[model samples]
Target: MAAFDGSTDYDVTLEIPVSIGGLELPNRLYRAPLLEHAGDDDPVDRLLDELEPCAEAGVGLLMQGATPIRGREGRAAPGMTGFEDPDRVASMSRLTDRIDAHGSRIFAQLAHGGLRSMEVWHAGYRRRNPGLRQRVVSKPPLPLRLADRLGILSIDADPLSTDEVYELAADFGRAADRAAAAGYHGVHLAGATMGIFQQFLSPFYNRRDDEFGGALDDRLRFFEVVHEEIRARTDVPLVTKVPAETETPWFVRESIDAEEAIEACRRLAEIGYDAVVPVGSSPFWDHAIIRGEFGSRGFDDRVSRGFEAAFGGPWRRRLVELAARIDAATTPFEAAWNADLCRRVRAVVDVPVLCVGGIRGRSEADRLLGDACSMVGMARPFYAEPRLAARLLAESDATAVCESCNNCVPPQAVGEPGVCRTPAVLKQRGEFEKRGAYEREGGNRRRDSDGPKL
Candidate 1:
């Protein structure tokens, strides 16, 4: 059988080193940030052993995901670092030190889940309610008015006071300083709809009439100020993942469509973002981002749990499962699902653009790198093969074992690390997590005072 290119092969060795935000990464294969939190409280302890595999695999960079910035305001769940914890900096530095030892550049993905609260804002809602669309809290409740009319998860959020918004921007800068102290090569501030940064941008979440909302430019003030502040604080590279103007359903108040996303990429590029990663859908709503066959099906049990909690008839139970399945369904598996949008972003900015969707094996990656993208990121594939990068460099036909099952995702907030659920991968993940536990108690790793302070 003839491969698409008529050449049954792929290669990463010939790829050129590219500079993003002044950090010249060795190759284009990036270990996309996946939310593999190290249990609830001892993240720093388990991080080194958990991440050592990827660094040893010869990945160009390891982007640790969802490093929360503030205390209550930044955290989405336990195990996430908010940089406010006294011991977090020391723990983060230990993780970075391990990466440095393996010669892999590292970046902490800074984030704050804003209106997207883990705690239900009101008594009526459930945990991290799936689509908590809101109106400005000071104003009359909008989504609440329609809440009973529809079956979607709708709740009210306390809109940030103008003062609070500005303070959040300052927090981002401080967080970047902390990352630098931790020996990271860079930091990618998460501006996804799931985070505070996106809460300020998407009209779905931002409903204020003051300086922070209304027109697109007005809404963008937060992004501009936050990134500028981060630049002021650190010399490390800055990157972000955003919706890229992809249209999301009305119920999901966290995303803006395709054209809006293009404007977003251009605006961020102007503000000195080292790279912009454009995913297939808004970070919160679309199943396409994970490229799941059925709306992140192998995961999203929370959706059903929330629905069951809200309306618990046997009929509701059936409906809940059906809705979750339908909600997460997407197109068939295809490589570079976000390539088109990324190309548009590339045309607008000189900075590198990263496209992540389903760049499964070497072929898809090589194809996109040859086209619009500057780099490629794979999240699920890494779980299937931590050594996938090194393996691919040696064998063009080396494919990742990850079937995009997505079983490792929609993370276990309080429990286990979200490791690959495939039987074979599951076994390996158990062994890895066990060793990570041992390292946590070894008592010789770096402590808070041993690392730099912000």
Candidate 2:
């Protein structure tokens, strides 16, 4: 509970202020946008229940994970909650109050799955063609190598057109408007994982030859339109998650170089974005493992800080000061540094920074304030235990730990609403075994063939 042992200067009140548009935030700690397949039909409301716990955990900003804006997609998971209906808007409004009671601001991340949409898979494959052969478009199609990329087992991809693109952007804005109406602090665009945004941005995915394709500027147009719409319609903050660039063992072409990422960051700043979060394996490496590995070590932080460094503008300056403050702390990672990326963004433009990934301690909170981060975010750990942030700040003796179990990693290891199945989460989930049956099946089957969690 006490940030320090009377040794270093540690501030417990992580109520750091950050400004986005006209909104001022409380601190630098946040709950990363984590998807909880808690739907209208589920017996338990997964993410909705975590709001208060996360607020109690002292999260100044608590943002939920990618909730779809388009209702047509249906439920990827049997009970996935969505923002497509007016009724759900009221439900979210009530949910926001639960988080607000804890003094933490709440936001909903709006998204569309695009090519990687699980709904498309479920409906196209599971329901329509369970026994169909694999089908995929090869990046470099050639003899003897037709099946290069993993086939998603679906025949329902209708390449998006410019009009459709515009429509979707508006849909995103509409969702943002709804979230704002629901009293969310902000709404972030889920641009990662070849999501709708990323697919448009990446040449690997987008085949459009119109104004929405080609150059990076062209590719980023779809996002710009959506962002502009959100800003024009609502007063809520806007944040985006981008992949950083790194080239260690592999080369990531779309992975924007730090400098390019900075340029993009500056562009977003100019566009009036509150924060830009970069998540993934070294942004430098084109090789992303498991569709979710940021490498086991630095992962998200390294990409975030490193990218901020590459873009040394007003945004960079804010992030730098914030980073200095976070580097001063003794938490699992540098909260300020991660937040600094946002602060630096704030300095140049009129916005605040929000850091995310895997934060789970007050040490992180102290660092966020001490460093200068407007807000820091916790994801997987928080996903496993909704009240995790509260326990770290209020319960001094509480030594909660994320076993780094891959339960929360979706599409790569487990299913949606990844449960906490690590020894710790298992103890918490009670039905960890039942929940982790998939892992057990994969692990058991793999052991016979000498494989891994993939």
The top-ranked prediction according to TM-score is 1
Residue 310 shift from truth in candidate 1, angstroms: 10
363-386: candidate 1 lDDT, tens digit per residue: 667777765677888888877766
Where is the poorest 10-residue window by lDDT in model 2? 438-447
| Native-referenced Cα lDDT, model 2 | 0.52
Question: What is the per-residue lDDT of model 2 for residues 380-402, given as tens digits with 9 covering 90 to 100?
Answer: 66656665554554443443455
**lDDT for residue 381 in candidate 2, whole number 0-100:** 66
Evaluated at residue 53, the lDDT of candidate 1 is 75
Error of 1 at 82 (Å): 2.5
Off by over 4 Å in 2: 1-13, 42-45, 74-79, 123-152, 245-254, 281-350, 358-361, 364-373, 394-400, 410-416, 424-454
The RMSD of every model to the true structure, in order and in angstroms, is 8.3, 15.0
